[model samples]
Target: MISGLGALDALSGPQRFGGATGPLAAAQPSVSASDFSSAVAEAANRTIHTLSQAESVSMTALEGGNVQARDVVDAVMSAEQTLQAAISIRDKIVTAYLEVSRMAI
Candidate 1:
C-alpha cells in the first residue's frame, strides 16, 4: 500500500512547506505523514490550476489564430484526464480509510 504522505509529497512538491533553495538549487522534499494533508490539497489545487491554464491557453489560441483548433481540444482533453486520475486516487483513499475504521480493535 502507498503511504499517505508519500502520495501527498508526490502531489505538493516543496513549495507547500516553508523551504528554500538557491536559484540554482532545486527543492527536494521528503514525504512524511506531517506533509500529507498539505500535499494532497496542493495537488488538487494544482490540478484545478492546470485545468484553468489549459482553458486559457485554448482560448488565447482561438483568439490569436496562432494554432489549429485541434491543438486546443487536445490540451483540454489532457487536463480532463489528469483531473480524473486525481479524483480516482482520492476515492480509493477514502474507501481505504473507511475500511480501516471499521476493523475491530
Candidate 2:
C-alpha cells in the first residue's frame, strides 16, 4: 500500500511536517500564499498535475513503451487518492457554505 498522500506532503515542501515522529509543528506555516483563494488554487494546481502525470503514464504503457507496471500502478493510485481527497474537500466546502448561508445574520 502507498504510505502517505504524496501530493499533499509535496505541497510547498517546507509546509510539510518534518521527521517520522509525525506531529505537525506548532510554528507558522511556510507556505507563502497569503489568502484562502491562493491556497486552494495551489492545491487545485497540484491535483491537476498529479492527474496529468498518471494519465501520461497510462498512455505510455498502453503504447507498450518502457513503462513498468509498478510505476503505472503507483501513479494511478496516487492520482486516485489525490482526486478523492480533492472531492471530499470540495464537498466539505460546499456543505459549509450552505450551512453558513442558512444562518441568522
In candidate 2, position 32 carries an lDDT of: 47
lDDT of 2 by residue, 32-85 (tens): 445456657777888888899999999999999999999999999998988888
- Weakest 10 consecutive residues of candidate 1 by summed lDDT: 1-10
Q: Listing every candidate in turn, what is its Cα RMSD in Å to the true structure after a full C-alpha superposition?
A: 9.3, 6.5
TM-score: model 2 vs. ground truth: 0.70
Off by over 4 Å in 1: 1-32, 61-65
Give me the runs in candidate 2 sitting further than 4 Å from their true place.
Answer: 1-34
Put down candidate 1 lDDT per residue, 1-105, tens digits, no spaces. 222123455534345444544553354444456667766777677777768867887888968968778888877876787677787888999999999999999
lDDT of 1 at 66: 80
Clashing pairs in 1: none
